[model samples]
Target: MGTDKRTIAVRFFGGAGNYANVLERCFTYVLTDNPDEAALFEWVKSNTRATSDDGIRDRLRFLEAIGLLTVDEDRVALTERGIEWMADTEPKLLFDALAENVRGFETALEALLDEPKTDAELGAAIADEHPETGWSDPSGPAQHRGWLQSLGYVERSDGTNSLTDSGRDLARRLASDGPALERGKSYTQQELEAAFGTSFGSYIKGISPRTDDDGALSYVIVKAREDGPYGDDLEGDRFTYIGEGVPSKGDQSPTGANTALLEQAEGSTVPVYFFYQPADSSELRYEGLVAVVDARYVFDDDHNRMVYQFTMERLELDHPAEFETIAASVTDGGAASIETADGEESEPALTDDETEFTETQRRVRSGAFASRVKSAYNARCAICGTSRESPAGTVDIEAAHIYPKRDDGRDIVQNGLALCRLHHWAFDAGWLAVSDDYRILVADRPDLEGYEEFSRLEGEELTLPTTDERRPHATFLAAHRGLHGFEPAAER
Candidate 1:
């Protein structure tokens, strides 16, 4: 039974670590002969010398935490999910398959799962495993680990680890067939140019995926004088006009000066060019022109349904007379009529009046105060080095106040540090705190065993902002330490 079970265990985990090996062995032992704690502990002790009784207990606890096993008094049994997960040939395979379907993280993940190491361990191992694959940085493995963990391919507990059922299935699927290589498939610039033509290629320069809709993108091209209604005078306007072409909701509209000009030209039925000159500048350059298009032939891009391209058959260079008529009509004739007849008596000053603050005003005031605190901390969270953007763009830290606003701490800039949200909550709840010199401290708790990521953050020096005067207040730190009953040495 032991030999058969060992064979089954090896087949189930497929060259995993000591903890995984132990769990499989335990499950096999339990299924073959229902063992009590004493018997199970003895079996584990004899099988793996690297794990102590306490280590074994912790491993079991970790498994229970992950819903793989359950313990009642001294007896332990495999969970139905755990039993099914172990019995399955390819547990992590589904995650790999899904990851393969997406371009970004799956390739790195497939490589990592091929070996059964924890993220940190896997990151360290990647250099040795595939030194020739060009991704030699230590962060490569770390990022892969984070990606896999985020995607639920791997589960970790108290420094021990196990492959999630999804990860197992993914592995099996990849083993049977070949691993997906979606990351290797991307369109090159030359390929794109060949496929879409030069004009279409130029259109994609400012194109981006539309925020409000799925399956649609947006393109904002700089329209030349030959393309739209304006000419040399309005050429330099940064926001030539604001328009939205929504396909899903079926709402399309053009607005601003362009729309106004387009409406004026509709009366004459003639193509016209429009131009606006800055009062301060004398430079004249061709801007945009409006030309009649065969409405039947205009076709929008498949990727960005909002953008349309039409064939230009003829070029016309004159402004329609209706433009001048419309412009003159809307020129505020009343203002032109009101001649300032040499300094008429001015109106008297209005008296100051008391007013109640609206809810929006109150919130705005609160946000303003929070901004001041965040500025004081130089837009960085004091506990962790989380900034607006990491060098790699992975972590984004936010501004957080050390003292709660309800506790009478002023919402001034002096009270805030830019911290990641997690660290902000930790600092507020007293699970963590900063020293006068801005060093980090963590509360002592055994149950936070799995929180190695957070635990490793303690005692690390904070990355101060560029300004020297924006340092955290010593008075605030002293008061906090006094209230919390813990103090650390100050920074040099």
Candidate 2:
């Protein structure tokens, strides 16, 4: 009995149409036999009755165009890259066909090709490129192109065109390996510390993840270092709160005492740090202290740290009204009451027993505090308008002591404004002052030029806060001007 060529053709083409069978057979024959063009054509004609000479020639030319087959004169051979490509696509219809079905591999292949084509180019080529397959919706191919671009197999040049090289290599590797590669673990201690601008040892020790066994993905409890020692203690041994579970692997539930200690630490003002001694005797540490300045100030890694450090505090102060509004809404039902020394009821005072700084210390701290407040309010220097984009970007700015620390001017939030170094010096020297309504004033210094800019600002109002409640205290400003030997700027 004759070898069943029709059965072989049917087996290859079954669900796939004529074109797929032709391409697969061509690939299989070329790969196995290493034949030139004329020989390959002759072999195809002898083996398969459906392949016409003209049709065979056209397919070969198409393969050459798409870089599947290379030709030298009348001779044709698969290149080593082409052989690797064939191996990369093995059994013809399995992965490559599936990739084309899923849009993953096809997109990757398009990117690997030199001079990537645009969507229209790809759409036009799809019929010729995937000749055996018929697409009912163009969107499938279009979506595949997008998927390829996302996977880094194809890059868009200009705005409309796409191409790839690295993506092709990656796709091929992924297809051969069956898409089960594990993602690499997160940063080591040194790496995490470098990224976060704080010690990882301190952070992990302070906060425990909400889910004990699930790693640090959920809610966390802050550790209290100053609140005294933790764990059931009496003997001099340190009972590390590694987690709610066992010190060794086989243990499931954490000891009862450790759970109680963790529950006590949650939502407390005091920071918590966590230390874990692994079963392998390796130690892992993390810092749990989080400073809520502004989103800008909280650095996650090196790329974001510098920007955060420079702008976070300023952003926080500038939008104090917003923060206050948020705080009010959240704490409305549980507002802390304040009691004056004269036994009068009042709103919560800024200073209390729990406050970090004393009144005298707050006065001294006002100079630095004011600078930070100004930096946030102005978003840059108030004078000379020095901003992040300026050539001399780091021009020194100070938070001029509106009320002098020596005179007991309070370091409270309201008595501050952003000022450049020059303006700060001028203010300190009693060369300028602001009215209760925030108008700028020039001192009666004969040496000073007091140009149109300075004169214009004299009665012009400073930018007011979004919330009226946060307006600078007129009494505080008046007290500052009086102490500084300057009359207040007249109201606009």
Candidate 3:
């Protein structure tokens, strides 16, 4: 008759995280203190490792439902039944209730009293007591262990378990009661298959990679240059990248390569390595392991298909010296470059043209940043709109700093302007300059041979970065004017 009453709860809440474990601790804590709901939650937050806000709130409702307590807004007051429970409440009462339906709760806890056991060892013991119960399943055991920890009865470390102070007391009480052990019911494989749509076995998901002729996915390369976009986005711990569109060569479906990327991003330590390099020189910098936490689908007009926007969380990185070694092995990532504070030069990065730079304000200047910036400007010179492309991945123009870095300039988009080789040389030689109002101010140098092009830029507006952050700062222009000694047209 006693076991029949327990069976009812097991039928309903057995598979659910054990209810009695949290209930015993909640009742005992309340009897000792008349804490308000908020204050009591603070205590729970500090004391328990596995108890959640929803779990505690649900248990509070349960206590009130059973006439054990009365919850009045913020205040929690114990009823007479609750006071009696405080006098002699033990963990076994709840364990016995769960054991009736769950099959292995009582037996597993009892086995722990003898010695600390690994999960495999404990699961073996649970299987011996009730072979048909799902207690041996790690998915199920995690909940049982959480329940025990919530009750402050046991702790597990390094795959071994041991009883805590509360557990010892509970063990003594259960030993004296000498409860009878019997398998309440045997859960069969058919029942398991029916419960879940899939068969009662492991679901193996794998990496669906698109193999190149060389049989490897290309590394997602980042160009970290001093004058290009800094890795400021990654410093905050989360890194987001918008990869090139799907249907990447071999697959008929758009999601072919993207599917592999998503699988690689699953929980914990995913084996995806991100590398970084500076602009100009061919060197790579190893970043670290990252996992894909979220992915979004956005339409790409370039390929007329959807591209993947992956939000990644970084795990750990190799040491700085080791990263430098890794980066040096592979080069030609075509990122922008910049000079560090210590006079160290990194990859040549890129920046976006005025339209996009103004929107993102990204200032890091790596080869990648350079590529984006050049694309924004259509790879043309900002002053004269002239550019030439080379087959060896070299441009006829170079990104020039509005305010030279040698004079304490930063490699942000706003401070950079793409110029043809002739104009780049002229600007650096102070033969030409840009006014504060963005007008071109070619110096009056009659001695120069190509006077038509130099004279053409006198009133031309300089093309800008996409966003305000990437755009050149006013103070930088003022400094450049100081060096070249050119005033705005309006000032003249």
**lDDT (Cα, tens digit) per residue for candidate 2, span 1-492:** 122101101122112123344555677787787777778878777767646767766645645543457865466787564576566444332334335323234533544454566665665555555444453455544554554444345566654554443454443434331112112222345654453344434445433433334442222333323322223111122222322322233332323333333222211111122323233433243322222121111222422222211100111111112222222221211233455799975643333234454332332233235434543455444444554422112234455446664554444445555567667776677766777767777665556675544555565556544444444556557776786666545522
Candidate models: Cα lDDT each? 0.43, 0.43, 0.51
TM value for model 1: 0.27
Which residue segments of model 1 deviate by more than 4 Å?
Answer: 1-245, 248-361, 373-379, 388-396, 449-451, 483-485, 488-492
Q: How many pairs of residues collide in model 2?
A: 22
**Candidate 2 versus the native: TM-score?**
0.29
lDDT of 3 by residue, 1-492 (tens): 232221111111222334454555666777678778877777667766535777767656654554567876578888876666566665544444344445455655778878887666766776776654434456555555655654567787876777775575455445432111112222233442342223424421112232334855422222223233212244555766554332454212334545555433321111344444335533334455444555555554555555455666553433222222222322222233466899986533232222332211221123333444454466688877777743212356666766775554444555666778888888887878776677778777677776666787677788765555455555556667778877655676
RMSD of 3: 23.1
lDDT of 1 at 21: 44
What would the TM-scores of all predictions be?
0.27, 0.29, 0.30
> For model 3, where is the 10-residue window of minimal lDDT?
5-14
Q: For residue 357, what is the lDDT in candidate 1? A: 37
